[model samples]
Target: MARPSQLSPIAEFARRHDPDRFLCALFAPPERRDALFALIAYNHELARAREAAKTPLIALMRLQWWRDAVAQAAEGLPARRHEVAAPLHAAIAAGALDPADLLALADAREVEAEEEGMPTREAFAAYLRGTAGGFAVAAGRLLGAAPALLPALQRAGAAYGLAGVLRSVRSLAGQGRCLLPQDALDATGLTPAAVVQAPEAARPVLAALAGESLATLDETRTTLRPLGRLAVAAALPAVLARRDLRRLSRGKTVSLDPRSLGDRLAVTLAGFTGRI
Candidate 1:
């Protein structure tokens, strides 16, 4: 086991790669911030596994390693000696965090490895629920959110997750992947290849996706309003989603950069105001 002093590396990784969640962690109770960062950093590791792996077999193996590590940590056994795992083990052992939620997150990434576009809208929603929604539920637990608030957190996470997918459409297309559903492409008279080759022509398809995301975001905010400050804080990233959707609607390019000054200011205000 690592001494508490050694957890800085995990925090640093979260700060560098997941700045939005890293900023959100600052609004968490000081004692819980490190554990929150560990969870988010662990998410980053799993979410990027496909890109990091040259082969599907390698990605599967990497995900399996995380699955086994989470199971071991849940049983109070030792975990592998890696930066994210060590701190993740510490967080899980501390209670509040759930190994099942982490396992579901790892499982969700398999979709990225095996498929280019989701077959249906429901399938995409499920993917977001498992990955992003699961993370919010876990983070909310760490913040002592009540059971009633879980659904609200899941909705907020789904909205935020969908927005993230929309914002990354161009980049995902560049990677030879398209997260847009096949039905959506068909409706727009576009194809997966066209999304990558003719992004301008595909703007309407992206805009419709953004519209759905905005509606979900509205619902999330309404659901979380009665849950109080901590719940609102947990859903702060929805503010960025709303902003991105607005940009997409106006024919402006969505900025996926986490470190943008406008994003920083918007997130900071939402954190202080406890509204998204």
Candidate 2:
């Protein structure tokens, strides 16, 4: 592992707050590593709005701050002072990041800021598209990946993102949160209260979602066959995402937390072999 002393501030922030993504970012070329980390770190801050805000209004205000910062950065103006802001602006100024995609990701977080959870299955998928999918698009651009390589990256992001959500069904249930589509919950005859009280019963629903995520990931693999190593690295986190989905499909109640050596080894192998 790289020492904190060696990693840039944004890189360290990324590793601490979003380790799985940090691992994937580490594969970018040395010169681009910091920019990738900046992107990840910025995304981390966007997610933080949920925990830090006192209410939905506060959360939306927090997200608006990021949108404002991005607008400033896009125009080469000074952005609001924040740990991640300068580096994020630097990434954008270098042409490695896109303001539009960053704002889109922030826009997605508005759903999270709302008191109501995702209204429907379609809305939930669209949320993931705007959040994780948008992040992958930014990372791919930063890595100098071909525009043609983006759809695969977005699919990889959605698969990995959904797998992570499904893996946390129990824990999120305990908190009265459900990442599943509202319709899916209704279809399963599971209510938010029911899930919180008996997370075990939510397994079938979570397993079905995991299977869907796994299928999405498998489809992405075919797209990977033609990508160069840099582009492959951009979506490499999908390897662990696949492992997680398989675990859920088998009814294994694994924690959503990273598996340290196992995760590193799996992605390292995929990175070396370019096999997805």
Best by lDDT: 2
Q: Assess each prediction's global lDDT (C-alpha) against the native.
A: 0.80, 0.81
| Candidate 2, 93-188: lDDT as tens digits | 888888998998899888877667876878888887778878888888778778888888888887777777777777777666666777778888
- Give the candidate number with the greatest TM-score: 2
Off by over 4 Å in 1: 1-7
The TM-score obtained by model 2 is: 0.94
lDDT of 1 by residue, 105-207 (tens): 8998888877555877888888888888888888887787888988888878777787778778788777777877778889977887788776667778778
Residue pairs with backbone atoms closer than 3 Å in model 2 (clashes)? none
> In candidate 1, how many Å is residue 55 off?
2.2
lDDT score, candidate 2, position 50: 74
